[model samples]
Target chain A: MNAKLLEIEGLSAGYGAVPVLRGIALHVAAGEIVTLVGSNGAGKTTLLRAISRTLASRGRIRFDGRDLGALSPEAVFALGLVQVPEGRQLFARMSVEENLQMGAYLRRDAAGIARSFERVYRLFPVLFERRRQKAGSLSGGEQQMCAMGRALMAAPRLLVVDEMSLGLAPVVVDQLLGVLAEIRGEGVTILLVEQDVFAAFSVADRGYVLETGRIVREGKVSELAADPEVRRAYLGVAEAG
Target chain B: MLFAQILVNGVLLGGLYGLMALGMALVWGVLNIVNLAHGALIMLGGYAVYFLFTGAGIDPFAALPMAMTGMFCFGYLLQRLLLNLIVRSALLNTLLISFGLDVVLTYVAQWAFTADFRAINPSYAGANITLAGITVPLARLAAFAVALLLAGLLWLLLNRTRLGRAIRATAQNLVAARLYGVEPRQLYAVTFGIGAALAGAAGGLYGVVAQITPYVGTSLTAKSFVIAIIGGLDNPLSVVLGGLVIGIAESAASLYLGPTYADVISFGLLVLILVARPARSLRMA
Candidate 1:
């Protein structure tokens, strides 16, 4: 088996006084698509934030054999872990092209960035058409595409996407999932946090069921889909067995 | 013809005023730092140019870049080492700290440069040209041109460059910026440095036109605040236009009312605008 690209153990995190994540542990192997699914306010976003080092947390996060302790968010990003945060937080006033360029802010190689720009434009052709338009003007689906494109511009090893389907139409969600698979085929690891259990299970190889900040179940997506508790509580589907 | 000349004078002075507010606007827009000490930084820039001219015989125009570079370094270090520490604190706290910084910087300038007024008087300082029956001071015209050039350069930097994109991105969303591998601390310092550099340039030109004393920062700071609000935070050109509006207002006020009412009119307009359309400036502070 390939080595674990990201390993989190005994992680705990929270906003100032409101503890959100407690004793959580998870891992994703190289080139794997891992999904973390839970209801709203279940600490899914907080876990990703902790892994990205954007929030203060107590944990041992070993990424690519390096300890991610005491690293700033930028340092964590330099290690090739990037997050497409919730709300498609594109610089609203900036043009789509400029927003994509911002994704490569730390990079100095001109040719490499140009290639990334081409790749992103090809992946989302609408973005190419609206390259000069302000990002805020883009539709919800377009903004989502721009956000994903922006994340790709960073050439991330692990793309952490939070709330992939939030505020997106079903068709757009399916389109994004297809793109995620294509991205995974390019050898980038994906750690996705979603409230849409069924949607996440469709693309994810492995899954974790988080309940109020704690991982209650961890298994292959097939097994998770079969789990009666998960089906009843999250999938809202009746059990066959 | 008299009105046209007054308009030109007001516009020229307004150019310098716009340059003064540019830094404040950038810092406020990007780093969310309302640098109360901005005026003091301008004073320091004036002193820097004054010394370079008096002691080293460098031309005042040539000394402008030197002052900008010096102030940039000073502002950069001040942000990296000091301001960043309290940046995550409450807005009121940041405001208080900046005010404290203003006090300290003002006192230091007073100690080093003395309380006497100084001006940058080159050999051609009194040179003038008459264009279409309007008398224009050569230095003021040059300063006005420089202000426009600087504002244009700033617009290009923000729109056409990667670093500028990073700075703007950082301003819009810190978390998103980090994902792009931007270290906020360094970026914040750079933004503040650029703001200070603009202030320095403004001060350098200001010394050519007006008297420079250690105490000039307070009123200048107030003027900058008004201009920044009038201009809005995003566009550099708008900020310059905002400065022009104030310049014309001041020129007209001083001419029609009295010299003493120049400030009163400016402040009064600010209050009127804010009270009338609170939506404009409310988002900023």
Candidate 2:
């Protein structure tokens, strides 16, 4: 059986005419965790958005052996390729439970949804504890967890996370990374975008370094960490790790 | 005892008023468009029901479903063809277009129905019940009951059903709502149609209780806006309670502060609510 889960070739996209992601090419096998590390405005979020069909792009995006670029965001989600967009855009006025219920927005099987809620609760006990609270009332860390939990409610085969570590303390980031690692163990393909080089490398099996909307280097995390130039450019260190 | 009667009267009338705001709330909450034409749509519903009952000899109560169905179709087409064209445009532009639609609709209504008052006077319109020294107009009571019933139905649609959930999701985030396999055009059309239908039903009830004329559109639209804001945008029934609040306030105003200030009070409340909670409404907008 074919194992390639997602393949992007010559993907070019941007807001109107100002192109951001230029001729980007990448692939992810089933159940592999890949991280894209880039500085601000490097088009990492745009790439994820393009895959989710939230942005207009000219490229071939094949997800789980099907063209994804043609599909709308909802259609893409139906295919089990969901994106947890940046900024944790939870419906603030909605109760935490209502917000979570939205995660199963496209689903019909109530029984399975009930079971998924149980799983989500098990994953993040804080969300379960404050199920009735307003989502906006939750702190930033909790909101991020809620965002992840909401995305998981879709039963995604591939999860695209944008800046999960942003505006989070080290301890909170560590906790989130741990949960992500656990999610990875469940054989879910992950495309992680982050500015935190350390966290991205720590959890990702392989890493793609993006500089100003272009891929500069792609390799195994260990191998990339050992390269002097990659270390200097991406990690802000000249010495080999 | 007189005060008690006044309060009961206010509560009953408030139920229908809440119903009026319910549609506006639903459309505004989910569609993210403060439908300036909402009251006009309600007025149209009233006229539709009025003509159906008076011309066709259909029982006024029975004619409701037919009127609702007609309004729903009209609203659906309006949204799908006209409103959808500028839905993606600037908010100010959408508001102006809806306002224009309101003007056209008001003028057309005046031409068809003529410049006169209309009330859907079923035989049962005058029947009343006395409970604990308070006289309850049977029509008003029935209208209030139906109003609550409709609100209950809406609550069920939005919470218990998948389609309802998608509607809600769409309201919160249009993209996310679409991600749930909902067609934006179809979904939006359906939502607006439902809103119109609710307005039609409310207008039918309201016509029996109060005077409705071509000019009624401006005030009813303002009242709906006031109730919707007072009720907040999250739940449908809270808006009914909001209506009740306004209803009681108006009742008290009529008895004590005089009737002319009723509109003033609600509009004042609207201004206060909008100004005080600009942050709250800002996020949703």
Using Cα atoms, each model's DockQ against the true complex is 0.75, 0.45
What are the models' TM-scores?
Answer: 0.94, 0.92
Once all C-alphas are superposed, what RMSD does model 1 give against the true structure?
Answer: 2.3
**lDDT tens string, model 2, A19-52?**
8998898888888889999889888988887888
State candidate 2's DockQ. Answer: 0.45
Which pairs clash in model 1?
Answer: none
Per-residue accuracy of model 1 over B1-285 as CA lDDT, tens digit each: 989988998999899999999999999988887878889888888889999999999998999999999999999999999999877568897789999999998898889888999999999899999999999999999999999999999999987877788888888877677767777888889999999999999999999888899999999999999999888888899999989989989998889898999999888988888898779765542
Could you tell me the TM-score of chain A in candidate 2? Answer: 0.95
Q: Which ten residues in a row have the lowest lDDT in candidate 2 chain B?
A: B173-182
Q: Using TM-score as the measure, which candidate wins? A: 1
What lDDT score is found at residue B173 in candidate 1? 79
RMSD of each: 2.3, 2.6
